[model samples]
Target: MSKMIFVNLPVTDLGASTRFYEALGATRNPHFSNENAACMMLTDTIGVMILTHDYYRNFTQRPIADAKATSQMLLAVTVGERAEVDRVLEAASAKGGRADPNPAQDHGSMFSRSVEDPDGHVWEIFWMDPAAVPGDSSTVDA
Candidate 1:
């Protein structure tokens, strides 16, 4: 079986976060959604679970940082083409999210754009060309 990636993030409100992610082209997985949390399926292999602060705190004893003022993690998702990056960012902004105020990277072979969810979770939508990617390294410096 292929490995699936799941991202767990803390949100102040579940419904608001769901709407924010939905606007970014993610569909909610009813199987994992509830009042305390919602599973946002970004793709077949990539999924994000946005949980309320109270619910997420149950998983750990450490304090969870308020993402709006402090960044906990940055979520990066790839696309097949650079256009998809803009498409996703636009959709997100339309739903109250904000686009990162910086130009996308153009490493000759790859391109990317970024957005911040309502809760301040950062997601980078990018496109990569296999031919341009380094053979020995999984990622480029750019």
Candidate 2:
């Protein structure tokens, strides 16, 4: 079976965060969703788990970082084309997310933009021409 990834994020408002992800074209997986958490599937293999701050604390003892005020990590998603990157940033902004939290990156063969979710988590949406990459062809799809 192909490997899958599930990124968990702590959110202040579960419903709003869920809606934001939906606007980005992710589908909610009811089978893995409930009052405290919602599993948003970005693709067949990539999922984002939105958990309430309280619930998220169950998995960690450290204080939750206020994503809006601090930086923890930057998450990225790659689309099939350059236009899709712009489309994603627009959708994110429409759903209460902050668009272009960081400057957009354009390197001819690649393009990327950043957007922050309602909770301040940054997501970088990008696209790259596989043909322009120097690595083995098998590694280009990611």
Candidate 3:
């Protein structure tokens, strides 16, 4: 069997978090959702489980940190093109997300920007030209 990934985030408001993810093109997966958690489908193999703070606490003994005050992690997403990267950043801002917590990055073959969801979880939206990969002479296009 293939591997699947599920990123779990603690949210203060499940409803708001659900709307936030929906704005970013994620769909709701009813098969794995309930009152305390919303399963957001990012792709066939990837999902984000936005759990209420109380619900999330059940899984960890440590107290949940305030994401608004400190960053716990940065989740990255890739798009087809640089324009699409910019597009998602803009879409994020329009949908009540915070954009550009850090300056944009350009590494010749790759470009990336960061956006934070309503709950302050950072998501890196990026585009990379695999053909232009650096240091891998065998695969990189001339």
Which is the leading candidate under lDDT?
2
The top-ranked prediction according to TM-score is 2
Per-residue lDDT tens digits for candidate 3, residues 1-142, read 6689999999988988888788776899999999999999889889999999999999999989888789778898888888898888888778778999878999978899998888889899998886776686445354
- RMSD, every candidate, angstroms: 2.8, 1.8, 3.6
> Could you estimate the TM-score for every candidate?
0.85, 0.93, 0.88
lDDT of 1 by residue, 1-142 (tens): 8799989998987887898899877899999899999999999888999999999999999998766677666678877776787888898888878897446787867888888887888788888877766675565676
| Superior by lDDT: candidate 2 or candidate 3 | 2
> Would you list the C-alpha lDDT of every candidate in the order shown?
0.83, 0.93, 0.87
Least lDDT summed over 10 consecutive residues: which range in candidate 2?
133-142
Rank by lDDT (best first): 2, 3, 1
User: What tens-digit string does per-residue lDDT give for candidate 2 at 1-142?
Assistant: 9999999999999999998998777999999999999999999999999999999999999999999899989999888999999998899789889999999999999999999999999999999898897878566453
Once fitted onto the true fold, the runs of candidate 2 whose alpha carbons sit more than 4 angstroms away are 140-142
Better of 1 and 2 by lDDT: 2
